[model samples]
Target: MKDSLIQSTDSAYSYPLLIKNLLQAPLVSAPDQEIVYRGDRRFSYREFAERVRRLASALTSLGVKAGDTVAVMDWDSHRYLECFFAVPMIGAVLHTINVRLSPEQILYTIDHAEDDVLLLNSEFLPILDQIRGRIDTVKDYVLLHDDGPVPDSHLTFSGEYESLLAAASTDYLFPDFDENTRATTFYTTGTTGFPKGVYFSHRQLVLHTLGVLAALSTPAVQGRLHRDDVYMPITPMFHVHAWGLPYIATTMGLKQVYPGRYMPDHLLELIDREKVTFSHCVPTILHMLLKSPLSRTIDLSRWKVIIGGAVMTRALCLEAMQLGIDLFTGYGMSETCPILTLAHLKPEMLDESPEVQADIRCKTGLPLPLVDLRVVSDGMENVSRDGRSTGEIVVRAPWLTQGYLKDHKNSEKLWEGGYLHTNDVATIDHQGYVKITDRTKDVIKVAGEWLSSLELEDILLHHPAVGEVAVIGQPDEKWGERPLALVVPKAGATAPVTEKAILLHMRGYADKGLISKQVVLLRVRFVEAIDKTSVGKINKVALREKYLA
Candidate 1:
């Protein structure tokens, strides 16, 4: 009986969670659903499936086979969306290149990924031209252009993206394989050292898609992402699969609009034109939209946006709420396939004031279903859920990347204990909401007391004069490190917003015991803009080098 239980049956069939499976539901149920790419093109899901197959066939004909890597350097567009499915479906890994990286970094990633085939947009030709000789593994190039004639290039081109798709047959078979096969890879934008490549498996991605769907659909009042919603991704598709929403959007058969590049006016226009109901981005993008002159002219009331990739301040949340936008925070990193928690409101808390709701909405939030999240101390003990005892966030989930690609040392550090360490310091409330205080390395230590840089930044953001703010620890002999703030004043403010004025405002909070009394406003420098990561999160590492260094 024991042997029989362990043995496989001849009649048994195993189902693998491949990317191809994700296409089935949408094809059958919403075949006619529309997919728009900026103002240039539009196609139905029926056409989308055919295009995906054609793309797969084209790549296959060009010597792409199972286990090969295909790299793409393009803006967020329908072409990218097609590659997201087609490459993986053909049993090849998709490398979503971050075009915003420096030329050297771009070269490093391309070489490191060992990309076999590259799909290049005409805009990025200069970048390739600079490093063409150094690129080792890439054998073929496919050019992509949006408008006008495809410009002549020095690099050898196999064929144009559209022309290849047009000539290729749409009946190629996408074979089934082990669900654990690696599907996609992209380098993480780390502050120190070279960017680390984080890859996800087919099983991981499909599970992540399902996990996201369950989280969004289960929520009652706010933060629900449904089928009827028109979706657009402001988050770059190259970044953690646009926080993994593109897969979710496609799986749900939502009408997806791809804004080619993140221009504030263009994004606003697309939102107004497409009646785009849902989107996701980091805080800086939202701030940019609010600052745009065109934003005041558009109707943003119907837009539901998920803010991730950085700390979402209460000030920003309040401003978005005032505009009738549904904005909330989500928590994850590149290592975790990026969506672990979301700051969706509870049913009991629905009656709270907008200000109160905004505060909750900006929190790190509870764990998504099947996400085993814990805040742990140095000894690996779980921290108290008192909403004050902060610890490193360690997690165990089905979808997290096993480790960094080809970097065993960092991979072990990433998964030191049984759980994967997130390197973020956070606390949990009795109600199970996780609020991140600061990254483990970003905490400001003043006379042995740790102050959250994020907390200070949040407090500074409450000041009406401040448009955007970033807080970092400055070296100090007296106290180990002092908190320094860089602020950008709101546009059209008549009041003289000085460093002293902002310091005084923070001092008021310090006196009232609202924040740590140790957190005296040491200095505030008003700046025109804050530096951001490629994906739009505040680049505190860059600011530290500029100011504190």
Candidate 2:
């Protein structure tokens, strides 16, 4: 009976049927609702749906078939949003190629993905021009342009975005798709040896969308996902599918504001003009906004933000709270559908003091419903939730990728024992709050003791002069390993030479006393907003290679 029930559950509630139903829903329900671009160009759901159908039609005409990969290389724009739905809705896999990577890496992904067609924003033409010869499997280049002469390239199919839609039929039929059919493929930014791909099934994506929606609106967590809510995704679309916001907006009928090129001033303008109620971005973006000149001109009280991609500092969180922004944090990874836990208040604590609420908001958060999170020590022993003992975080969820595309070895590592290993070392309290202590790769080992780089970095960042800091382990014959601090001084500030000055600040903490004995503060040579991944993580792997390796 149990076996039969499990089989029955898998057969019902899939991605293909959901899209058909969503398409039939009231297009004009949010018809006047705008997906703003560049503070000017906009598209409502009704108009957006029409364009999506046309694009689907155009893609089919060009021989795009089910199971083929379609690559989109661009910033956040209306065109990118359309491709997010149209590509998958039509049964082709949408590969959001990371634009921040090197031209060679970009070309490698296109070739590895075996992209059937490449859709690019006109601005990327220069880089594409150099790599166009390297992408062997790509047969067509569909230009997604706003206003400019068509870029000249060897590939023939070049035309304005609107023209292609105008010529194509909006009546193309969307095929019935299986929930297990791969809908999207995004490469891991940490692809060192050879890039590995994680594909999302339609069912997984739909579930993720619903989970994200629930996480945002549950009064305990209070996300800005209400019907009247307007959102601006400061996170790039290529990263974790912009943390699944665009799709969530589609399903929830949100009025979205897209900031092209990610200029600080432009983001502020959009937030003010569109009256945006919600957004998700990294802590660095919040830092920039707090320091940006445009910040003084706009009213931030209307906004609520979810900070991720890195640890959110208490200083920044308090600062945002002072500005009347409802601040929260979430934890997830590229392999686990990106959102597994969020630092949202529970019903019992909703009426707690602001100080208590803020304290709760500091932790990584409770695991979302349907996501089972556990912290394990020595790979197998589950750690107690006393909030003292730390362990590696592992998760199991319906939305997690089955395995890396074509690489069974690492894929096996990713899903060992049916749980996705996060590689993030954290501790959980009795209240179910998770506080990350260190990354498995970033932990500093000294005299058989493990010191958290994340903990050290957090402490150093509190220093007024410290702009950014990364703690890495360096070989030490006496201690076995020692902590090497790479410090990025605050803008227009100089780094201090004495280790005493650094230790003076962290003197009281017991961890600091141990760390102080082995801490070596090294002035960072190149520190311009430390290189981040597409998802806004401080790319510690890259930093370790540059500094420690």
Candidate 3:
């Protein structure tokens, strides 16, 4: 390669790609845009910037400085949005604690991340009390309350959130730093072991924000996000920066609504009251909302939702479309700054039948800009671009995390060939669409042939009485391993679901050549519910242990 280095004048400004720089255009273009909380409280982007400065001053008074770790444990709210910008803008790494995690994992993550200052919501006070003495790194605490004054708790707060913000000056300036400095870190909610920390730099987050904004704001028929669109996030802000949409929203100066805690009816009411136009979430949350009685009475025609964290079932997609809701899929994980692909329908495909559209929508998606996604074999060679053939997904992207924090051994495994290994098995078709068939550990090998558990689950979801389903591998004396499915029947199913009934349903698909004939050996179990991870993904590792062990 030719040497491309160039020199600049001595006085030239090397503008770094810092998170604070993302504010410049929005402050001018949309200074008056509103950021609302739970459909009621509201503030302008002008005030938001001032609050960010005030927060920086407050955190500094509490001894937070450049390179310190500031942790937050709160639900999705305007307060979380302030932290998203303020904490990083002041040259500190923000750790968004996954409050849904078990108390033990919560403690482990807090200590593991070496949190220096913790700003906590009152609802999480009990949890803090449970492990107050055990925490080692948190030197100061700030209370965050929504309804009233801070309640009684064992942990002492250095100050309350709003009080500090109101008392501080808006003149506190954020200093420039290296764009590669770590901006955010959060733990992955894996099913097997203690969560591993993933960190992203200021450069990575800015790039992710711009890339996702470019993808979502681009011209499209159904799911494009525009300035006129009102945005809400069903995904928690703590999880991968709410898949990094908050930053993108702030960058574009879009009207934002934060639903503090995810409650179905409450979300529906907010959607109706605020006329929410764009949002994203996991499949489980969407399913719960569609099942709610209030959702039936509301007008969802103006809404568009992007589904991730788990596969979006064809049934759910069709149901949303019938209600005039524009729903699609997005793909990524905590380590990737959480945006890799989106399943927006192509222009021509927009005129196709609803069934064909849902078929496309349920596929993983087309990779986002700057995302080099591939399905490769064990040797790191690319697999054929045929929809039928499957291999592991490996990718190269500007925003992908360099490695797991403080863990040397597993980090190398994650980037074995300089490409981040996703451990997900997928296939890319001629049109460049990527469809994940199954996780490497989740794929079932039956009768010497590999079978996709995701495929089995998607097919079973079509059953009239089936509500939710997960497929796992079970040992069979003859075949070595067979597919066993756990099914959750619809709430008001007219007919009781039996093992034989579901097995017969699987046989129907096998007969149609839609699946492997080995599905003939499938077994079924009815359950009240499927187990999920902390972030609401199906926990197959737990399922295999519970059902097979």
Identify the leading candidate in terms of TM-score: 3
TM-score for candidate 2 = 0.92
Judged by whole-model lDDT over C-alpha atoms, candidate 3 comes out at: 0.92
- lDDT by residue (tens digit), candidate 1, 1-549: 456456778998788999999999998889999999996689999999999999999999999999999999999999999999999999999999999888888898988999999999999998887786888999999999998876666789999999999999999888989999999999998666779999999999999999989999888758888888999999999999999999999999999999997899999999999999999998888988998888888899999999998999888899899999989889999999999999999998889999999979999998999999999999999999899898999999999999898999999998997899988999999999999989988998998999889989888888888777898898888888888888989777778699888888999989999898887736788888888877777888899998876
TM-score of each candidate? 0.97, 0.92, 0.99
For residues 251-273, write the lDDT of model 3, one tens digit per residue.
Answer: 99899999999999999999999
Residue 190 lDDT, candidate 3, scale 0-100: 65
Clashing pairs in 3: none
Give the number of the best model, judged by lDDT: 3
Residue runs of model 3 more than 4 Å from their true location after superposition: none
- Which residue pairs does candidate 1 place in steric collision? none
TM value for model 1: 0.97
